[model samples]
Target: MSQIVVLDTNVLLHDPQAIFAYPKDEIVIPAIVLEEIDSKKRLADELGRNARSVSRLLDKIKEEGKLHSGIKLPNGSIIRVELNHRNFTQVQDLFGEITNDHRIIAVAMNYHVEQQALPEQERKQVVLVSKDVLMRIKADVLGLPAKDYISDPHLQADDRYNGYFTLHVHPSIIDEFYTYRYLMVHNLGLRHQLNPHEFVILKDELGTTKSALLKVNANATKLEPLFLSNDPVWGITARNAQQRMALELLMNDEIPLVTLTGKAGTGKTLLALAAGLLKVEDEHKYKKLLIARPVVPMGKDIGYLPGEKEEKLRPWMQPIYDNLEYLFDTKKSGDIDKILMGLGSIHVEALTYIRGRSIPGQFIIIDEAQNLTSHEIKTIVSRVGEGSKIVLVGDPEQIDHPYLDSMSNGLTYVVERFKQEGISGHIALEKGERSKLAQLAADLL
Candidate 1:
């Protein structure tokens, strides 16, 4: 039997083109979903942009045929808008409130009931696809099959790319690497292909303690020793091997895109900031340093607090300021602000206002990139003009977005998608340099 996929408003908002995702199955967009999408069309955020995108797509496709009955898509799927199946009695008891979620589930439940009455051979499985966890649980309680809208299946926690791996070889290979600064990829005789700019630790297969730290050259043909791996950036130095690898990628101007992922206290922000300052201030490589981060709140909204745009963002951007204060090691209050004002080249803007920007000749650092969706990140990266580089630094495991996870967030998405690209480099830092207590909390708590 074929399947009938019911999409929620969040699914469309998460991926505006999700209607084409299931080419072999019929897709049903609940009428309530249209209402929800309409409400979000004026959000002035990612969700609003997505709602508009969905509206435009639906508008274009509906011209083919009426959406209520069915619209035959080119992908061999039947798309329809569900207007008659919103029987609230079908799901009212499962969920107490008559919220939008309840209405969406009502449509799915009515479809399931109608399909059940048909012959077993003719009944199509009705499934709810959403990004909400509690909504999925509620649907399951109502005897409906629900799932997450996972675009990529290989982004699971265990299957993720860590940017570096240990290659155990004979002692002579290690000695040969030491004798010659660079070793050919064919000479290494590795089982798996190494990605461009990937880090490696050539270790001896025998129990002997011999290893060398190297990175894949841009061509992915040779393992070259770290060139700018140990250099201190603005008085900050790497305290570990992974951090050193991250530094190598950050300092390399040839690689235009970089990704750094780790847990809290891993110094991802500090390292990226230090590198940006070095490139923009000391080296004069770019015209300025542009740093932006998502304004996702942790606990509660500070809407009642009075302030302008800058003051309103203080609570959200405080973490960035804290890192700057420590990097400057200022002895007096507001000294970091004075220094930033004097620089005139460092702009720490909010991520909300990054749209329609054509950034060029700048060092761009996006902090907490995990909260951004794949589409949102794509929008930001596409703004990079010539002579500009973008560094995405975030801890995937620390995502706070309602619809994102370590496996599905934009940071991990970019890390996997760009792993093999010659213009990008990635590093996953495990060590936490903040403090022993913080590291312990990150690991144990």
Candidate 2:
């Protein structure tokens, strides 16, 4: 039996095409949802973009028939724009406000009540779907069934990581870590599941042997990587059987793009920056080093800042500056800027101008990439020229784009789409290396 689904304002604001997502099911867009979208259509940013997109979609659907009655979708599902009715009076009595949220609740409540009046066997189940947590709770209080809309197909729990593994080995594996770079350990008779780029710490079971870090290389076709780096990079070391596995992926220059996603203080940006610096500055493998990030306002924009382009970009780029300063240990801001500028090899350009330009033979780091739309991300990646390495780092859980979420954000989209490609790599850092307080807040708060 087809279900009756009432979408809230947030659903349309999050995804404009949500009306057609439920094929064969009756989808109803409350009049209040249209009012909310109309109000937001004049604003700027993703919310406004979604509002306008939803408006256009609704208008296009109107060609089929008047929305006040109903329209049959391409998949044969019925869609309608609900009209105001006595439902408002009951909702007002419960919610006691003429707010858009209250009106959406009223629509769902009325539909659910009407469904209940019919025989249980004949009535379609009325479900109010919303992205807003509070709105879902409100629906429950009004005796209407509600749920969070999970339209994005790729969204998974925060703990999801495709290329990772954990291993515990004896500390004596240090010698093997240095010599072989990988250990098969066939006779040891131990088997531990490992991900492509995961790390393992080996402690000596007999004596107080210092723990040796080992990485499981992603593409170690020749021999298992057991060799340990003289110094650990990104706090992950290669020890024991997985050492070879980790190195194969980390040092595999074949992979052009490497994305590290994690919550705040999880070392995603720091580790990528360090790796880029090592490859470009120390290794001299790439011709240039470039960094860029989206210019998203925290809560709101300061309108247009009266200044040059760089001045306008300063506020959003401040975090990047802080990272560079810390990485270079530069005391003065000018010192870091001077070094970055003097090294004609390094260029820090705004993402706005990266569309038409073709960047090649360079190491690119795009930080806080979660704010970008999928279209924007495609443009950025398409600009990469031959022999170019790009790293996109962001936390999906902390997205600011109104039209995106943990699953639909550009960062997650890229990760999911490119995971199978041989030329791309990804890592989800779990440990928070910033501070005890930062880690606590990221996990608890």
Candidate 3:
């Protein structure tokens, strides 16, 4: 059965094509939604893009018929823009205010009341959908069926990468760790189900003789490198269990998308850049190393950022340069730039130019991915061509987007959805590895 759904302003602002999201259903946009869109049209960043998109969508719909009446969408759905009417009194009675959200709720309430007058089977179909939790709650209080927009239907946190494994070995293997330089457990042979970034602690047949940790790559090759970095490159190293797992994920080429979460100074960016450099410059796994982060401000854009493309990107990409300089032990800022130029294969770009472009044979890293909407993230990830590995690193808890929470942020959503797929992998780095004070702050404050 098709449902009658009234989209609140937040839903429209969050996804301009929300009308088409509910296929085969009647979509209604309250008049107040337009007013709210108008107020936000002049803003900047994703919200502004949505406002403009909504305007364009409504304009395209208007070509079909008068919006106050009804129009048929190309997807075989009906859409109508609601106008004030006597039915609105029921809304006023319920909300007792003409606030914008309430006004939009009024349109949905009127639609529900109209449905109630229909046949019994038809009366169970109207729902008011909004991205705003408070508005959804208010709709329920007013006796109207409501739901939040389902941006991600597949999310499983319990199945996320835990980064540990167990290997059952013969009791004789106990001597292998201390006596032999390495162990080739030929008995475990090829086709073993160890994932690319998986780590294992080999235990004796008696389970008490000796134990040594090992890592498995995609080729099913086992390498038992030192468990920790001895030189402590870039003044950063795994400081906690979560961070140690995160390091394993970052260093492993098999795990394409490594998701890290922590407060500031967790060394997320530093570690990601270091691993990217190692793979691109040292290992030659990819043609290039690409780094990009969303340009979204907390509430708005920087208005008119000065200079050319590289100059304009400096303010935002400066943090990356700082990390690179620290990693390379370069005293001059230009020294890091010279090194990047000498490398020639590495490139830093802005996210704005990434859309619709196919990037193949590259190690792509997206920082601050939590700032992106699910749709935006889809657009970015879909651009990954053959032989390309894209890593999305972000802290879900620090979302600047108004409509996204930790659960809905692109990083968390991707981690939850792809954790089960063997081709994809995720790790939630919980510990701060930047410094003693930084780690202390991440835990205490």
- Compute each candidate's TM-score over C-alphas: 0.94, 0.80, 0.70
lDDT tens readout by residue for model 3, 1-445: 8888888888888878777887788888888788889988998567888999999988998998998888988898889988863355766776676777777877788778878899897574779998788898988888888987766545444544544556677767646655764555454653545555555667787757577666554454554544455334335666655566666777666566666655677767877787778778877888998999888765435457777888878887787788788888898648988998998987887788687799998888898898888778888888888877888877776887788776667777676666545556555556565778888876788
Each prediction's RMSD to truth: 2.0, 4.9, 6.0
lDDT, candidate 1, 367-395, per-residue tens: 99999999888889899989998999998
On TM-score, the candidate that comes out on top is 1
Best by lDDT: 1
Q: What Cα-based lDDT does every candidate model obtain?
A: 0.90, 0.73, 0.74
Clashes of each: 0, 26, 0
Residues 129-233, candidate 2: write the lDDT tens digits. 988778888888877889877666446766455444434556556567667667654433555434344445566665664555554455422224434343655
Return the TM-score for candidate 2, rounded to 2 decimals: 0.80
Model 1 stretches with alpha carbons more than 4 Å out? 298-304
If ranked by TM-score, best first, what sequence of candidates would result?
1, 2, 3
Model 2 stretches astray by more than 4 angstroms: 39-44, 167-251, 302-306, 355-357
Instruction: Order the candidates by lDDT, highest first.
Output: 1, 3, 2
What C-alpha lDDT, on a 0 to 100 scale, does residue 189 get in candidate 3? Answer: 54
